[model samples]
Target: MSDVKKIATRDSYGAALVELGKEHDNVVVLDADLAAATKTCVFKKTFPERHIDCGIAEQNMIVAAAGLSTMGLVPFASSFAMFAAGRAFEQVRNSVGYPHLNVKIGATHGGISVGEDGASHQCCEDFALMRSIPGMVVLCPADDVEARAAMKAAYEHEGPVYLRFGRLAIPVFHDEENFHFEIGRGEVLRKGSDVALISTGLMTAEALAAADELAQAGIHARVINLCSIKPLDEELVLKAARECGRIVTCEEHSVIGGLGEAVCAAVAEAGVACRVKRVGVNDEFGHSGPAKEVLAQFGLDAAGIVRAAKSLLG
Candidate 1:
């Protein structure tokens, strides 16, 4: 296999938006005083007329984007995960979610991976917050390439979509051509019978690496990249429960109501009795440090996945 690229998921959103903007004239990009930080500056430079920077007010930016969507234009609003989901949630729920608007929320710096910014900027509860909102499609792309494809899928799919990206420069696991990405479908990266590793966002890469490590230790692990969270692929999750016998779910979000909890709900409702272990932020505040180190400190890294897999097996 060729070497995978190392790119931040936020970069993928910007690059994909540029391509989408070139293909469709009706596609508009909006930013909340974070065009440069959120990487929407590229789109702004490319499509000055279509790109709208709504200053620092994320709530107003969301309403403005929703207004554009009502006008038949596809608007992608960009902001940090914390402010976008927390501050602008009411506007998002009322103006966008209530109307089932086709507005795309591209939230970068998601979860603890924001690093150095501490817990204030770390939106580990974003998945839970957005998923609770009605008619929202929560998307957490695994890598830069997947983030790019997610941008396209979120745009094509009608309704309110929340795309979560991170600041960390993680490994690009999925090849843009080979990995088939649909809005509500889960992609199985590797198949195994011993245990299943269900993950999303940058944690998917960690899951894959942990799977490889487990394989070297004679533990076969299946890796499932769950891109869509809200309209989760229950069929795939049930299959993992029935076949794998045990599961370990990983995500950058909190363990409370994030990917791990979501998977458990699917397995339980399906009446599939399987061992499930979760590795993620455990409802604790994070400290200032590098993204990778902070993740390791909080037990959201590959070592965490490996430990969870072994514990579940035991």
Candidate 2:
């Protein structure tokens, strides 16, 4: 609808770091030899002195970032999701999460959307891993605007934060002037009554498309962007479960401990009566292919979401 402009969330994160670097002198960036791929090169180009290249050592980068945080510097560590969240899990947990350090982890190429890189680069369990860490805040921004906002929010918030980004360029749905984003807040993009489509990251665009399709079939679907995964907006989720009898969660990550499971747990804890249908990567490894094709293959597309919603409603 918004002129179909496609921009990668990683691009937004890169631009955000440059802006933040200019505004906050204490802000520093560290990348594990993937600055270009992670898009942190933008910040490195602008503020060379403030940027550190850790050279493929994600664990060392995590430890360095934690040490920088102790010195009152806001360190944004950038890397592929597989390395940032997987290879450096122990360092992140012990050095950052344990001390509640102000280190922002910018993990790009997250989920099966990493595409041709295959399963080794694709990280579907980053959310689960990061969410398990104590005092860790996880965020999966839906689009470019949300990604920029989330980057700023991560910088402002204290303690460890994981901001997930994707390699594929997705649709931009939010207007710059009208978009309001907070650290732990969930925004409802579309209002409906029949069912609620709760989604995070790039899958939110698909959820919106699904809502449009559901409307054509006389099924009023509420579209909620659950960007904040760790400190999930439980109140909004519960409200959706109560208002809309059926709930469908869409995400690019695995359904194991991602948005899908978080939504189901919230609904259950609230004692709300609702049937939840999770549309995600069903606990499997990613394959090498086009990102869009892979998303469709894994039932993370708009049509797939519509099917899931319809199935739950039935």
Top candidate, metric TM-score: 2
TM-score of each: 0.97, 0.98
Error of 1 at 294 (Å): 0.1
Per-residue CA lDDT of candidate 1, range 139-208, in tens? 9998888898888888789889999998888898776678778888998899898999999999998898
Q: Positional deviation of 66 in candidate 1, in angstroms?
A: 0.8
Q: Which residue runs of candidate 1 sit more than 4 Å off their true CA positions?
A: 1-3
Question: What C-alpha lDDT does candidate 1 achieve relative to the native structure?
Answer: 0.90
- For candidate 2, lDDT tens digit of each residue in 1-314? 66899999999999999999999999999999999998989999999999999997999999999999999899999999999999999999999998899999999999999988899999999999999998899999999999998888898898899999999999998898998889779999999989999999999999999999999999999999988998999999999999998999998889998889999999998889999999988989989999888888899899999999999877
